[model samples]
Target: MAHPDARGNPCSSSSLPAREAAEQALWRLMSFYDTPLADLDAAMAADPAWALPHVMKAGFLLSLTEPTLAREADAHLSHARALARHATPRERAHLQAVQLVLEGRWHAACRVWDELLIEHPRDALALQWVQLWDFYRGDAHGLRARPARVLPAWDEADPLYAHVLALHAFGLEENNLYPQAEEAGRRALASNPRVPWAVHAVAHVMEMQGRFEEGSAWLRQHQAQWAEGNGFAGHLWWHKSLFRLEALDIKGVLRLVDAHLSGDALQITLQRVDAAALLWRLHLLGEDVSAHAAGVLADWALGEGCAGDYAFNDVHAVATMVAAGAHGQAEGWVARCAERALGAEDARRTNHLMAREVGLPLMRGLLAFSRGDADEAVDLIYPVRSGAQRFGGSHAQRDLIDQTLLAAAALGQRRALGRALVNERCMAKPVTPLTRHWLEKLALPEAAQA
Candidate 1:
């Protein structure tokens, strides 16, 4: 049994000096987002049981690193919950909220956000999450509505405002409203050079117009900016992955996945998990993800205590199994841990086929195309609606949904689908490089004419 702190929170380390340092680290994080995570990490290393720092650490991973480590971050969240200051219900709720995100519970995550928002209407992070949570629930109206309430109080001078604005732009872009989407994206990124989501939003502008080279070149240069010195959101690599695939340069996708995702943390962190999921999807698309990727996912699975989600984790689980080429092994794990893959619509459902349904179909569609089943490939494409940007992930991870469907149209030479996909992208920033390249295979005369 762990010792409790003065507030009766479960304590991880018995050392007074270490606990004191971690305490300071926690205060620092809440006060400013710019502190070196390395310092907080040092505090954690000294006393792993210190709950607040871990909560902040989870925030760091989600913001500054990969978005995938929600599970491992939840381990810290678990301790935070167990050790939470019961008197401070709001903070306790925040701990539970962090756990909810780790669990991939979109609705529950939203409920948590709503509760927090009701209590602290000015909580910017909660407001940002409300929109993102609505995104994953696949409700465009909800996505737009939440932000509308907050944008009045939100300042473009604040970087997070632009980050949130990027999501609004993405929803508009996804819904096929180009001019407004472009303007929103431009405003978001203009507020902060670090707003890659918005930058990618603008890149969508370039992509829709058929300037594949221009769009690709533009986002390519912005990669370092997104992955460094800002609150982390690197799943944009998934967007880039689609671009590389569009180019039909398998090596380009592989190298990018490797370069961006090659290294991972010792413990399963969110950043590493985020990297793993994207790269694993790429690996399934014929890139070689490192052999140890499966081992890493396994480690994350072992570090349980996450609450809320079945969609995100199940998606990653399927990707891990698919990437390892261990369907039989995965089926066994699925049977044992069978509760993870059910859809949100079913009360009894546990897991979701997010990767299997959206991401894997593309990989499988490519495989089917290779095997001369273009019709079947097209059949696998699903009608997609994003509930929240980070419900499963942001516009970046789910962009594959569009690319996959486009691949279907391109493969089958379905002129209507191809044109529709192009038109849809045209309303936003544009298609990403991956979709453009994929569409090129169909060789639309209009594309050439443009």
Candidate 2:
């Protein structure tokens, strides 16, 4: 006889103990907490025929996106496909979604997960996976709205309901619904303070609204909640450093870098990106962070070892390499990214398009700016401004590209473009010190400020 999960979702395995253990492991994995992969291994050992463990493992590996992990994920996918005959229709649908991801059709995989949610709204794994892919695809509208579509199906009684609210809050924030997003995020945090995503959602709202002081205080107050064993600790610290930078606390920013963001840059792409981004922002502001950036590049083993196929990582690689004065490596990165973009299959053709279109120009621009060729940098980046969103990154992360443009415009003394861009920023973030300083430097008349 088949068993049911804790929330009563059907499992095809006859071994009830193994099924329950696998369910627990899945919950941990979906929660973004330190997942007990060994528990899943034990459950699979208990009953090798149980398909859910293999399916979950496949999903986890596919999400990692590292080339080695991709190979491991493929092995898991093959095993899951072999065991799909033993699973129920629902589990089979999940296997199909995993197959789509393995095939590089992530959006199609998301659609399958959406269908599964429509049928099994309580599938935490499906909801989390879909949200992750939405972020990776830079689908801001999908990130903000998809969870709301399925939220009515969940109740406060559900075990993972708060996490769903956190997802909704993040989506709302990304869609520019700051007030609603903040409320939902705070509610989720109040219910379960350990929800790092909820904490991150609130940070996004605060950051967007220019509530830098409030953002700093909130993150500092809640730091303990998200500090230990949380995979997102570095990112949360990165957000805090943004708040510090906005406050003109350069010392604080560097302190955060040394205290929190310091690590092996090559081991985890996220940490490397964070380190590079933090340093790049300082570099754009004309701070002397070449040594720090060089330290970051020391670990960046590019070419075959790195996951350069991810356009997001490719951009950061360019930023750090340029900052470290490794112009040759940056150029090589651009070329390799172009090759990968052109060579990608139809499923991820959009990523390839982004690489060929925006990624290449952005990297070349960075290289030019680093070499003090401000005019060349501006020339290369201006035409690609509208297409930056085609690559996968948040508004704040992508802001680095625009900042490069602004810096190049100013450095090249292209007063017209500099005036236009600075005024636009002023209108959007009227109280921002950086914008105000730029406006003053531009010597724009008082009426133009209004």
Candidate 3:
């Protein structure tokens, strides 16, 4: 996509409309995730000097599915950034935030996300920020609290308020308030049947209630519209990825990534909640997601001369450490958390956030399990105490927490922990092969006396 700003008659040469176009392009660009590259190309061809599109296209190229073509897009994005003095505020904000996320500057993104969340409380596009940044940092209490402050009239303001409902519901579920969570999710779906997060919550309720077929079937029914509309097709299965971790459709998840990650010079921006969650799924499935997503994630995590607060910034970092098997990195992440814990306004609040906020504490638990420190592992996530249903995260997201805890219980010889997790009290159904096999082999009579 290439264009020149030639709006004025050279004789009079007033760069007014050209400047206007640049400004318009920026907002359009920020709000324009998931639209196909070809269409964006057509837009650029219609007006070559549009700075925002070029900036966005370049961002997409960096995360391209295909190397050769993405390089071409990169050339154009480089050109767009070069011409950015003429870009609009919205375009600049998005481009900058996008860069932050890509760079993994968690602290920066944390500050920026809070501002954007407040500024665009109901922006259809700001949800992207909510995913990549805010999703990772805060706790369950944070997730469920003060949504009203963000959008007090949220229900009537945007068609996408269903998403907030989904968030609210998931937040409640993470805290073990299943009944409340289910109701929130159902209300969200009721308002907008298309809200994927709402559907995600309902699915969780179904899973806990043992309506597997019904839960499974809803995803199949809405997968297409949800994908095309949100650019986060994988999220449909993301919530279900928990109990069915063994039954996860790895190929399906990859296909969704493949469909979205095409390396066409212009990248299709998708919903942050959808795309980032899909990336996590891909990571869990043991795919080489890091290679393609590292830059894209870094772009979001780092932000441009600013900060953001999306939760996935931290989640993705931990997921990456897991994928890369970087033990030291995990330790450092904990060290950082410890630092944040010290200065945090409320330590209890932060811990509560950790319980469901991407389940990072759970990751620590798993890491402990890996090193044969089962008790430490279990202790790390003990706050995720059974029966505290408000551990608000997607069911699939919460599964990782369960997985780590179950493993820790068995290995640490915490029979009560093991039985509590595998038994019907915690999980509506009995243990699956993966959980059962792993737990049984942990040998509680052995090293674990805690």
Error of 3 at 138 (Å): 5.0
Candidate 1's residue-wise lDDT over 1-450, tens digit each?
444443334444676766566545443333233454666677667766555566656654543223445556766676676656432455556566656655545567677877776655545546655665565555566665565555666555543567668767776765556788889987876776566667767765554455556556767777667655433334555456555555556787667656664454223344455655565545534455546466556555432323123344444554555565656544444443334333334343212444334433443443454345666656654433332233345454555455545655665656577677776665654454444554465676656543
Candidate 2 is scored at a TM of 0.92
Tens-digit per-residue lDDT, 179-222, candidate 2: 99999999988888778889999998888777889999999889
Count of residue pairs whose backbone atoms collide, per candidate: 38, 1, 55
By TM-score, is 2 or 3 better?
2
TM-score for each prediction? 0.60, 0.92, 0.52
Better of 1 and 2 by TM-score: 2
Error of 2 at 288 (Å): 2.2
Better of 2 and 3 by lDDT: 2
Better of 1 and 3 by lDDT: 1
lDDT over C-alpha atoms for residue 334 of model 3: 50
Give me the runs in candidate 2 sitting further than 4 Å from their true place: 264-267, 305-308, 344-350, 440-450
